[model samples]
Target chain A: MRDELLELVMNKATGRASDEDLRRIDSILELEPHLWDDYNQWHQEIPALRGVICLAAATTEHQHQLPEQIRMKLRARMRTALSRSQPNYDRLMELVNTPPDPQLSWRWAVTPAVSLVAIVVISLVLFNNRPDAESAAQTEVANNQPSEATVSIAPVIQVALLDTVGVTRGADDSTRSQFQKAWPAVEVRQFNSSAEFRDWFIQWPAARGSVCKIFYNQGSGELKLIAKINGEEKAATFALKNDVSELSQIIQQAQARLVEWMQ
Target chain B: MNYPPIERLQSGDSEAWDIVFEWLWPKAIYISRQVLTPLAPSDAEDVVIEAFTSLFERIHKVYSTESLPSLLVAITRNHARSHLRKLSAIKRGYSKTIPMNIVLEEQLPSQEETPLESLATEELFDLLEQIRLELPERTARYIHEYYIEGLTRRDIAECYGVSVHTVSGNIRRGLRVLREKLKYKVICTDDLPFRMRNR
Candidate 1:
């Protein structure tokens, strides 16, 4: 509950936290795990919080208008979907278009039958006439899908961080917190020695499509990526001048490469 | 009593859709955007689009004229939920599951839906009115002015001889009270910036 912890948590949550910020957070949390519970509680509350805010809008009829481009985008997407000409949409719709006031009892009685027929009609459409229209629709969706990068859905990449042998091995992987801090959904494990790391690495089932990258710290700031993924061992190495200012830049480039490899 | 141009909407008239869009687009987007947090504004727009797409695909089935707005609201939220579910599933490597063909649960009959969800539009309005009555008069006034009357904080402040901050605080806190009373979660923590940015 410290202000610094809150700041760090928000920075990490909002994807603003640097690796150093993440490490500091890990170190802090390693010392005080209980603080995380309070933060996680608030974090878990967000979905429910979001649900209620929307529910408030629903009940109160909150007024809002999207920007023109967003409106246009949605409009295009809808037109494309309707253009597919989903079969029998008109038939079920005919049943549904009854006048609300006069048909209260009649509508209720028929709803079950209508839903049943609709389900059957939908099944037929999906199974019989669906593949081509759906594929075309999917192509349309992929083409029209928004490329705007948003961090709302956490990244799917699982990262493994390996450092030199001098770092002491502890009860938990120290690197775990660093990776967790770096990416919201990331799972991490660290081994202080090659013996310890290899023991775990040997157990990784290649059949499971597993992949691991070993970044070697060769002399003269040479960065090498040796990955054994799905039984394929591929190594890619590059050298950079190890000037202090450029060290950070080189490390960033190396990290970006590693990220792309993992993905 | 306000109805969309149903004939136009049914006939696939672009103008009908335009009319529907102008009428319900704001409310649909409002409901759609609220549930997507840490999500980009674009994702919320995508949810709105998905909801509209679903409605457009099934416009033939739109039975109740009055239920159209609420139905869109329901569909928008439903799509947002489906979107989040699909996202989590994809994270778990279930990318094979596609949501384009997902059925509209809110549109279909469901037995387990809460009474609140099943409430008619008039009933929901009446429920909100009752909840408003339970709120403190000042809180209710702030909410009414801010939402119903569409008054800006500065306008409300000037009218009530108070600072804009007070108006802002009251409106936000009043909304929280109303929201919590209705069993919803957080309001826009940042306030209605998209709407209130110019104001």
Candidate 2:
């Protein structure tokens, strides 16, 4: 929960944490049982987070278009697999030459329809359940759901403070009070040590399948909170001026959205 | 090109196969490139073909079209790992050996995958796309160019007509944003074994 300790952990992870820092971290680990959970969370998140950054970094490059030669090879391979004769090309030619459907053409047109059909057919083939596509659709539906429907998936508030904020009472006490004051009925747990934090997360109530994990990245001076709302992730970022009141306001807004969004 | 129903693939329909290839080839190649960067395009093609061949042979066993993408991805990953293992072996033969873990820095938690790990791969892929789309054009472009295109920090800075520090800062902020968004963990303390219990 200590920012200094976390800095040490990050350095240690990157092989830059000093022996002194490691000793301090070890001491923190012994005293603060719940710190492990936060550490573990950071551990799991960092690599994949960087991997994603690396992945997105790569996506900016050229699109991986299939080469003509490779396409030909794949086609030939397909033909061989299907035991089709060379003259079977007529099937493709005939299909192409066939008159376009007037209704289908007028309504959807060629490119959009083709792309749409390709997406559907490929999706049907590729995934057992198209969670990404379906979840996006569900989010759209969830976003526009009527007040009555919104009442069904009542949101629960669960918050994690990943780093210590130079506050008098520990970050946990302050964070809990902030939430308790806002929505007294919500279940709230404050994690100060690794074990407690990790345990709290591990024991997240089965009934409430979603949670909000909040942390302030001291290095970047940003306050970030992420919510898993019905399997879709929604996140908000605010520039931190090291003011708890400012963070509380941003968190309040996030809580309202979660109430509306959580299914 | 018009693609037939994927169901026909079960009966060895070449046309269906063609359509599936057309639709998934780019993705397969992209996945390969991501997993095995510095891979030549020809090698990427080979990896894709190898995976497709595996699918072709097991078409009958594929009970549903669902999971086909996951299946292809898994196969591609395995092939890429195999390539890495061989590369490691070759490098070992030549000089001081590097551990496979060092060689494959992004080693997955395969042996003891948590429930989160199992779902994280597919989910993260989508989350990354979402984050990219949500990011500013310049920041997103910087990320894509630096990570995807294998551009160095200096190159990206040069390309964007910005300082290297500026480019790095943008990327770092972007990564932090991504990290915050995707950090989903469930700590089931009660499930811990005796050794790890109450540690």
Candidate 3:
């Protein structure tokens, strides 16, 4: 009876035997009173065994074709066991179907590093160009005066020196020479008022970092000069009544040329 | 109609490959999610997809259909474990280690079980899990899905993008491990039939 019950139980549990096999085991149990303890033990173990069987059957069905009845029974038993023993199928399924977190991926891992490099590069570029940009603006303002009128009259000259001269050793000499040679060719546009000249100076690139304004009275030979270096302004009023030097006229012409070239 | 067997996949019958993929995708995804519970849904999918793509490159050796599930489950577990290793390796300021208990909780069903039943289930799961972790990521995933989650070998092969032969090899290797681990747990010789115990 124990052997028959064992055979029936193993067959039923492994899905190798049919429900009839289980019935056969039940019959053996019914017929033998002494084997009841063993039968009860088998019954106690059935749920876990059934779960394993169901899982195995589900897996085995992929390769070996099982009888439909056996397959159905396994499925039913598995469903019952899994549902009753572990009710978290829905939760597990939901987790399985849930999408993966993108933050953990490699793309996001390097974002901070990438951003830091970008910021540093941008800062270096801006820091290096700031003074060059200011010097260029200052040079532009110095050039915007009328050559005919300013060259003949001695004008009050006000110059503001920069703290540091960022001369790019050999690369900038040619540009400097070019500016010196063009000094004689300077011609400024005539304006009725100093405000007009100031407005035009504001638009000039050289005027961006530094600014200069000249007020000249042809009859009195009086010239008022106001120049700004960086943001600080210096004002000088000069009387050219007694001055007749060629150096003064040359200086005036150079200033006029610088303005014309900038315009 | 000529139904191409698993061995023919490596020779380059794309249609045969497709048929296999269609069968295994859900099971593979299911198994991957079970093993890699800490990963988000998208990450799990990516892991599964990557495993399948890797599997597809070598699908020539799978000779039998019975070994497919085991192969897929093995692959899935290996992939998830590899991901965990990678995560751990890069643990810096923002790294998080998912609790092992939580991972097991997520993977297992959430129902009350008798102590004996739970122990048996745990034993079987532990055996498979250990075997899966030891295999290559793709192979481990194949086994987990096929054996634990019950997906077919053909389906697993297709999903893993491999030929049936390769999938079968994975299954064979996985089953060998499982048999070794589970041998002592078989209390009674009569509890498993000849066919089930033979492997």
Candidate 4:
């Protein structure tokens, strides 16, 4: 509770406080006059924080060049990585040059063919049910009327398939292509790191309200998948046995479940 | 100076490399110094290099400029943590000395944890310097008297020919300024000096 008050006070000072927060801060200050000293002390520190950040950020512009030795070291490392290409380049090339594993070849070939068929089936269903789709779109449009007139009145279903961490980093090309094939309509975006994905997910404006958020955390050598559709959320966790195959299976399962929920 | 588009950096554009290095390297060093102060300079440099290497491998996913700092810091922090972990493992192999990793990790501030518990006294003093610069001369003096000299409001009021209420108001007003200035950098305030139940 005190933490919440401090947050409110800090927010009020920074001008980020909501009305409720401001009210809370005001009431707290009024009630606990002794606490005012602590508040004053922290409040006074704000300028220093700003100064340090600015000074540090600006100091770089003045005299701090990436030290020559470090730059050289980074360049050499970059050259080495570039020469080697992607970490799995050799493995991928070997897989490409050799015949597909006899056991999986049939499955591999059939996956894309199946996805193509699914895409066609979905398309035909939408086309045949144009009136229904249009009505659904219209209802959606009506529900979002006035403010969203600029949005296309036509109804469209768009789903985003994203990886929160580079859990898919070592995924074989065949796996990637197959996954894309399975979800032809879903727009796929891969996040190579959890931090990158988390930051983007939080700031993503279009994902608010009833949208789906599929989070994948593979940080601790385990795959933890959570699918939040509307207010209901479901999660799965399992130790990743085979990095590539297991991740591929997880993606396929998540895609199937998400597709079911979307349609 | 014209900065290259974020897309170019993501694609391993050679020219964009210089600009990316320039902007991130300093901040990386700053954070590294804070995280690896007791470790060798080489360790901090290694962490920065590791961070950049990871950034390069995953550059394609960095869709925007706004998240660059955060992404860099996260990568740097992870590397630093791992580096410390490795050191701790090595030390445990050889000696009975306390694991340095635990000490370093404890020193590092975590966003998920309470900010107050994590803040070291030196950080507070550093902030005090910033606060002192912005306060009115009289209020700044009083801060030095109260916090530095351990003077009470009554003592300050007696010395300054003001009521205790006036002294409290001056300190509060000065602190309000600091809060406004520092608010952007602060989020979890549970450990803020005034929020302690014992205090």
Which prediction has the highest TM-score against the true structure?
A: 4
**Sort order, DockQ high to low:** 4, 1, 2, 3
Q: Tell me which of candidates 1 and 3 scores higher on DockQ.
A: 1
In terms of docking quality, model 4 is incorrect
> Candidate 1's residue-wise lDDT over B92-167, tens digit each?
5332322111222222222443334434334444444545445554655554555544666688888889898887
| lDDT (C-alpha, whole model) for all candidates | 0.50, 0.51, 0.44, 0.51
Q: What is the TM-score of chain B in candidate 3?
A: 0.46
Model 4: per-residue Cα lDDT at residue A69: 88
How high is the lDDT of residue B71 in model 1? 63
Error of 4 at B109 (Å): 14
- lDDT tens digits, residues A1-263, model 4? 34445545545655656688777877888887777766666565544433333222322222245888888877765554444445343332232233324464355445556776998999788668778877688768777675363443321223222332223234633534544565566554555432244333443235443354443332322333334434443333333454444656666666665555443
lDDT of 4 by residue, B1-199 (tens): 5667788765556667777778778767765655567854556776677677766765666666544554665556556655554454344431222222222222333334233223342343334344445665577555445543467779999998999988867766654554554553344355554232221
DockQ per candidate, 2 decimals: 0.09, 0.09, 0.05, 0.11
Model 1 per-residue lDDT tens digits across residues A5-108: 54455446545567997888888878888877645643443333333334444533535655678667656655655554554344223322322244443444
> Could you give candidate 3's per-residue lDDT for residues B1-199 as a string of tens digits?
2445766555545556555554555556665565567643445655555455434432444554334555554455455554444343233311333222233222222234433233322344444444434555566556556544567669898897899888867655644444334433543446442112211
Where in model 2 is the C-alpha error above 4 Å?
A1-36, A49-62, A79-263, B1-3, B39-42, B63-66, B93-199
Model 2 score (lDDT)? 0.51
Clashing pairs in 4: A40-B175, A43-B175, A43-B178, A43-B179, A44-B178, A45-B178, A46-B178, A46-B181, A46-B182, A48-B130
Residues A1-263 of candidate 2 have per-residue lDDT tens digits of: 45544445545665555689788888998999778876666664445444455444443433467677887776655554345332433432332234334464234334545776998888677655657988788768878875453456554456544321112132334555665666577554443222223334434345455665554332223444555555544555554444444657766666665555442
| Cα displacement (Å) at residue B139, model 3 | 24
Q: Could you tell me the TM-score of candidate 2?
A: 0.33
Give lDDT tens digits, candidate 3, residues A1-263: 45456545544554545677767776787788788766665655555443333333323223322334533433333233322322243333343234444443344335545776998999789767778777677557647754342343233222211101111111333322332343333332333222222233333234344555543322223333445433443343444434323225534654664353223
